[model samples]
Target: MKRRFLPVAVAITASTALLLTGCGSSGGDDDSLGKAKGTGGGGEDASAPASPSPKPAGIKRPEVKLPKSFQVEFAGWTNSDPKLQAIMDDGKERLLASYAAIIKGDPQHSALAYYSEGDALRTGTAWVKGFSDRDLTLIGKGRVYQPQPRISPDGSGTLFYCVDEGKGSTKDTKTGKVTATPAGDAFVLYRTKLRKTDEGVWKTTMVQTERRACK
Candidate 1:
């Protein structure tokens, strides 16, 4: 043989040493680079700030409202899970109050408490788009669609049951006013959704009706 193979062993060990030194140098540079940014990717710097959380752009959500009767199904969620419960809860309160407001014939004032700024803007701009304001006033004032003699929901939205007087306006009131007879009307219930805003609290949503249809 030309010589013993021990020379190969020496070469291998030398290369290993160089590789180890290079790796050590690179690792040290990485640590220093992280330190320059004051990051805690790998350091004892407790001063490293925690990651910032995202802010919500809209009102938070609240809790779910179980339908009191066969009326309305009040339920939902917001894109932001963190604040959805609160938002839904607020919405429920507003929705319940909305009926009371309408019953009192002061929907505008009720709107303040029941809807968010965004909702009010839409409700105002629509000016009864989905609603026949005149009919609403007619039936609403007649108390045919009474919200309730009184409301009794907690901070959440209200659940109200009412009897509509089916008689037309041609009948006479106790006086000559011609108030119709108190015909048996359908029993109805409703639930409102509420939310919180910068100006104050509001009902961002509303759902109402008896689960069972009017006979």
Candidate 2:
């Protein structure tokens, strides 16, 4: 199975095979990533369970620069809790950063800015490695929407969202040939678990994914 996050770094076996598209979320059937472990606090100390010690520079995140041709829509999504909204907002930001990293084939940049030491981080690492190993680059367009979040009774945060990967292609850096990405009948659904680090920043610890008919 291909690992999906911004995109699966699966090596392109055929000239027709495309790499990952959209943002970070693993691919598979109801396969979940990461574990829930949090003691919740605000501002510095929310970084969490097994994160690395503070580096001299601090956790690096991306500035998120989207292509002007790109379009993103929320699609009838809203949240009532101000705090939850903030967290969700951060989650989307991280997703955007993830997308940038995958498209750029720079998982290290993403590792520093987003994702902690967990399944999410692992998935991101694999994707970057896979693509680099094959000397392939993913090219595609996508939009996100329909994000709904649930707060655990213990106050742990979880989120569900969708990514629509439109038409695109993958290019072989070696041959400089472009292969059209296979068209999909539906969008991909993503389930993510979130935790605040000791620094009070929300980070994705785990991600689960599956494909379903677009509504």
TM-score, one value per model: 0.27, 0.64
lDDT of 1 by residue, 61-122 (tens): 33222222112223221223434444443443444333333223343543433353443323
Residue 24, model 2: Cα distance from true site in angstroms? 18
- For TM-score, the strongest prediction is 2
Tens digits of lDDT, candidate 2, 74-100: 443446786677567667766666656
Tell me the spans in candidate 1 whose CA falls farther than 4 Å from its real position.
1-82, 111-114, 120-215
